[model samples]
Target: MAEAAAKQRSPATPRPVRCIVKLGGAAITNKGELESIDERSLRSACAQLRQAMSGSGDAAPGKVMGMDWSRRPGDPADPAVDTDGFRGMAGLGIDTNFIVVHGAGSFGHFQASRSGVHKGGLHTPLVKAGFVATRISVTSLNQEVVRALAREGIPSIGLSPFACGWSTQQRKLVSANASQIIQSLHAGFVPVLHGDGVLDELLACTILSGDVIIRHLAQLLSPKYVVFLTDVQGVYDRPPTDSNAVLLREIEVDDNGGWSVVKPVLQGNKRGVETSVAAHDTTGGMETKILEAAAIARLGVDVYITKVGTDHSLRALKGDVDTSTDDWLGTVIRSAK
Candidate 1:
């Protein structure tokens, strides 16, 4: 009987994810303010997420219109959707096996930067204090995000990277328990993770950026695709603030993770595009985001970067946007031949 009980208690295998959506910190929070959330943008994002995840049978009022699930020619074959779990529900528009990751904008960045938490040296009183303060702030934001998703009738549970034993060595992630995330997916809950202060083998403690988290998750989960919802339309040839800055519609990434703009015929190194990081953002900002997106693309998973709360974001998340047309107003990073 004990053996039988043990067998019954065996962990279920994790389901393959349809996609992973990353909510940029700056898009959902007032980066200039201390711990201020952009309620309007957050609400809009949650609503669109509901629409994208809802099925045709759902009575939800703002169901997404004109979503085509069929893959386009030259596009990678869609990942197999699991048919025996929560995703197996009939009439579902898109597979329910997905993950949401968010950054720490005004929530924790100010405290972290002030305390120099990302610089390590936790043996110092300042670093230790900053670590604790940073966690408190970021986790507070996580709760708000979970509450917002819950309000939209989405089953979301906050998962902190620090709580999951995610640690780094010399600013590079070396250990993380992907099992926690997988188990959450297996149990039919959308795991909502956020950037947080984590232990570092060398530095003692450091800040793990959400962009890096997304890259690590993509490597472990191998989702069909990844979406980054940001404040801008997409990656640009120059700073978006510049009048002459042009949005690069599509970026082709080679196996080695090098990328180049395939649209509008841009010259010079796209990676060198000028971008401004927030004064309080300890993370590398746009440069890190693009680099991580390219890394994900190198793994054969397409990455979409678009403005949050836009139709393009919704379509990109649903994997039904027509990328060949000029109507697509986002940048798609895909593996080149």
Candidate 2:
């Protein structure tokens, strides 16, 4: 009788499906390390995120910023903490449960590749150098993001991407104790995950890029939504550059569906990045993001790809939208029956 009473008296817990928002590197920061970071664009994204989190049924968004943290021996953190991180999202009646996962935009991506120190990927001898570069770069970004969140009364932490315990054997996460994520969610905490060189069972190498991380997370956390802020508004029928390119508002992920490979709309520092045109060099690009998102969407999660500048990001979270942009916001590749 006592046990039954306790069970009945227990408050019904709200099982909120997790939320995954993957901000592309090009969207958040400038391309090359030699180039400058875009403070204005970053601020815009932060503001919208803040607004969305304060939205109805949204509560405070668990925030995470993942990056490749690295630094030269005596480098100080980026002095100008702009309006990008979650802390910048505050004051809009939104408190981000912040999690940050950033990439190694300048640090390892260039150095390792150039040095050829890391012959291939994770197992490369230059891995130590790569990890060093990744750590410094990622760590710096983490601190700034954390500091911003902390100032806003939102607790934040810098967790390593590799430490998340995800395997790339089948190109998906096979093991991870969801308890940590569960606890964080219950407490309204945001866990951030970014791409890093991880041990891959199939390729016998290391895979880097936040794209992989987002997919693994979707499968594990079963988030309610996966928002990828692609460089463009959404997918286009033809190459966006092709004067006749039409923006595809929505897509159904059938075995054979509608999605064409157009020239990449996103551009890095034009004067830099030898691999700038190397489409497959990076993690999942627009196509991969679409396919991955579609697969997860099949699991009943709504996925959206929108320009970081538009209101679609906020509207999508609200669960209703009428996209009116021509640049393309995003396309939902619905799963095949």
Candidate 3:
């Protein structure tokens, strides 16, 4: 009977995606304010994304603002470049099949933290109320994001992890209906997922972070590249607020998943960078993002971390920016082996 049941189940393979873009909640929303979105930032990010995916015919040529727009030799032969039917990037004509995952930011964090939702134990009324409140806030933000994308003619569908049978055990995601996301991608619709409160076996309930979700999806989809849109320029040797902090351009991960900065080694204080998480944030913040990026890098996918609504970010999303060039103001994580 078990063999018959196994044979009855059909296998679903996800299509090859060109890129996965993670919109940091801090980048799109005002973290200092409760449930407030940075409208200007969100609109700009959506516009830039639209431009990157659909291409801009009027963009300046031959290295605009120190970015290398110069077409590489035999560009048409690149497997990543596809111009058959889909709208391609300007000058490059590259097709981007991408997904967007966003953080909860101020929307759900306040509720989750206040009620100790991350701590679990759904037996309490406060925890249950917090779960509902968190979902309502995050899903509202998701709707706003999807609407913004729609305004730019991008077909986007929001998938709530909590509503979609994503469950965790001991705060670790054990199962998710990834096929729904894959099917959405195969149908040419952008699947937008977010950090959410999910049912847990051991804890009863816990926060499933967007960073963790990105890492999970990357492992399953194996996209060519992943881009993290942050509020800052990129990963720095120390906290970016510090005057002596320096941006680390490239990080290489070994076969065993260990990583080291490969460009512009730090001159002093190599004791590792210190990151500060928001008081109300249930998630680990920037530190978690870096850890997830490293995990994705270990899977042989290049990851780019850059500020949203910037020229470099737009280029990175379009898959045209060369990471080796010093002009690109971002951190890229890649596999060493």
Candidate 4:
């Protein structure tokens, strides 16, 4: 009986994740671009992400995507959340990984604004100035991200899209260092990426978003889940009000209302660079995220959009939920059968 009990108590194998999690800036802190990051909340969120990627126990093993990182030298301030969380998670023996991709927080917002980038839309008098400014911010942010990761025992490194990624005339990424990133994951090292400075293409410069890196990761790794943690609780039925607003349980790709149901506010600082995210399929907002997640579902991926709340992040990563609806704790985006 003792031997039988021992056999039953043997440690179970871990579950492999075909998942990619996109942690938004808002998810890290209340301060969009104006305020500095909240280390406590940020660290906790990362710790949960680590838990999900961790092996066995209350947590489940996974291949966590970018944990709030900037791969460039000039990127904005280092986010204490992801960097610190990675350390705590490392203590638990999880294989933590990240694809560092971040935006220009305080760094470029002013320069980009003054140069008149966002006002003129894509390219204008402020365009060149905006691009240059954007680069600086990205580098600064990346610097901080790298520092935080190093403080942890994850042994991660930075990667640049400007150096490695190429785009087609059709606005699609022609090539990227997907293989190298995968190699890092295989070796137990996290490969960080960020909203790149400027990638000179055939015609002009291409502004990269974390979404770009996200799509690439989804295509290459084909993780089992994709969790998007943001400041909002989840996609809402009309932007949330302290008074009354509904938390959507699930959202199907083919659902009638779609992105029309939720409004993505451009509540960033006055000095931020703006991207035009169309109602249709495009990168940079919820619409884009939902569409992309749906596309990845063909490859069998589960996508979750939730807030960066205290314990919720861990539950999402561990696939611990009690709802059959699309969005459980948050809005769930799924592909139609």
TM-score on alpha carbons, each prediction:
0.82, 0.66, 0.82, 0.67
Query: What are the root-mean-square deviations of the candidates from the true structure over C-alphas?
Result: 11.1, 10.7, 10.4, 12.5
Cα distance off (Å), candidate 1, residue 226: 0.4
The local distance difference test score of each candidate is 0.78, 0.52, 0.77, 0.54
Q: Model 4 over residues 86-177: C-alpha lDDT tens digits? A: 55563536556544444443445556556654333345546776767766766665656555555444455676667555443334555554
lDDT of 2 by residue, 229-314 (tens): 65566666445666755555655444343322222333332211221222221223666666666666665666776776676666
TM-score of 1: 0.82
| Residue-wise C-alpha lDDT for candidate 3, range 1-337, written one tens digit per residue | 2233233222865578888889899889998999999988888887777777766634643221111123445776433322332343344232436789999877999999889999999999999999999889999999888877765557778899987798999998877767788788877788999999999999999999888888888877778889998888888766777776778788777766566777665454232332232111122366677778989998888999888888888877877668657889988888877
Error of 4 at 17 (Å): 5.8
Per model, how many backbone clashes are there? 0, 35, 0, 31
For candidate 3, the clash count comes to 0
In lDDT terms, which candidate is top?
Answer: 1
lDDT of 1 by residue, 1-337 (tens): 2232233332665577888999999889988889999998898888777777764333545423222233435868873333344354455344458799999878988889889999999989998999999999999999888878766657788999999888899888877767788888887778999999999999999999888888888877778989998888888766777777788777778866567777655654454332232111122377778788988898889999888888888888777666678888988888876
Q: Which candidate would rank higher by TM-score, 2 or 3? A: 3
Span of ten consecutive residues with least summed lDDT in model 4: 274-283
